[model samples]
Target: MPGIPVTAPDAGKSALRRRLLAARAALTGDEVAAAGEALATRATALPDLAGARTVAAYVSIGREPSTRTLLERLRATGTRVLLPVLRPDNDLDWAAYEGPDALVRAGRGLLEPSGPRLGRAAVTGADAVLLPGLAVDRRGLRLGRGGGSYDRVLARLEAAEARPALVVLLYDDEVVDEVPAEPHDRPVRAAVTPSGVRRFGGVEEVEG
Candidate 1:
């Protein structure tokens, strides 16, 4: 019998993700914080967010910089924010978020909103969906934390007729030329980094 053959793309992506994670872990808290601030500044300047009312974003974990500042800025600008709640079925459940106090520690050390759990209708009303990923490519492909949670939720959102512009936040170095993409991996519309916001598969240029 022949052994299972690993595809070249899969192997390359695995190696790249490992290297990226290792490099990210080497950064100090202050560095991550500063990078996050810069990324947020660039993100807010994107035209897609100009009239966005409801936004869906994630709570960062570990060495990943926190989105607290961005969330506050959005709220102050009258944007209704939603955060994900990890369900027992390993799927994402969403809830309305007001501030940091609305979040509590959940399973796997992830912070989730403690407010009213919203349904698919609320998600479909969002103007933008900010994704969390280990890495992203110039093509908009996202490499998540080995979990299909975001993919599944994004699929659901699409099915609900929610065409919110998808965006991913990443470090400047995490933006690569390519990433191994699976069928279930939904590509984001744009990416925000310390360098600036880049539109994937779009004609928008990163302004200086």
Candidate 2:
């Protein structure tokens, strides 16, 4: 093992993800809650989501920048909110979010919508897709949790020629200088933080 070089892109990504997750785990409940509120306010006002009729988002677990508030706010605005239901193959199957009561417990400590499965392709109809990430670089490269669920979702959208506004939710500190990126890794259009919204690409120009 001494002579082995561990410079592969995936290795670097795993290390970065661990560090970021550790940092997030250190945040207090109050800190995370406050950030979630701010994110709801800032994101709801963003042009990318302001006119969106359908949004694909997820519920936050642990110390991740909470998406619960933003999801509720989006729903209150008459936006059709969809939540992911993780499939056995590690792919995401989406369903309509019908308020907090409709969320049922799922594996991996996740809360998923208990509505009828809309099939994996349902996400293609969303006007915007909110992704969960441990961190994002200034160039918009996202560091996911290595599950590759969102990767499949992105690919599905691409295959359908669907152009949706891609966004990530994170704490302000999670927006860093750089993150290792690979050729197939697509950059998100923007990231919403508690402080404000960070734009990296043409989020406003993405068509529904």
Candidate 3:
């Protein structure tokens, strides 16, 4: 979990993303699939999601810890799941998840929900948000893919004075000791790994 040596935030983030993405790419398909199942179990059990009516989530692609199982489970429980639709400017526009069949292949190795677009402000109404990230530090600072998509989501929430629980899904090893923090980088409230969920800040652990 050594952070990049560069002083610039963008430089540091680029280096970290390259390293983490390479490591994830090295994982076997079987490993990724198993991790996805475990992640689904751990994520669903989080207390933050207990009574959530609407959840902002994403569809995982390639070596990223998969969200297919988690999305299915959430939908089955009658949770209003919203998946991201990549916008022209790279900002995310959300839409209702109507199961796997509703997903359409998008550029940059992404699968997006094909439902009606719910404007950018839709994320602020979610009871919880499951973010995609390369790694998360002990402080809950998440290292995203540098697309600035989730950054906009967070900024919108802040502007609206929303307090939805922010969470990141990752493999166990992706939870690191530290990651370079920036002024705009928002710390997550919790992280769900294959083993279990871990709380940060003043967040409390979910009881089994």
Model 2: worst 10 consecutive residues (lDDT sum):
1-10
The models' CA-based lDDT, in order, is: 0.78, 0.85, 0.86
| Per-prediction TM-score to the true structure, in the order listed | 0.89, 0.91, 0.91
Off by over 4 Å in 1: 1-10, 202-204
Global fold similarity of model 1 (TM-score): 0.89
Q: How many backbone overlaps does candidate 3 show?
A: 0
Q: In model 2, which regions exceed 4 Å deviation? A: 1-11, 202-208
Pull out the clashing pairs in model 2: none
lDDT of 2 by residue, 39-82 (tens): 89988988879999999999999888888888899999999999
Residue 106 shift from truth in candidate 2, angstroms: 0.4
Candidate 3 CA-lDDT value: 0.86
User: What are the per-model C-alpha RMSD values against the true structure?
Assistant: 5.8, 6.1, 3.3
How far residue 100's Cα lies from its native spot in candidate 1, in Å, is 1.2
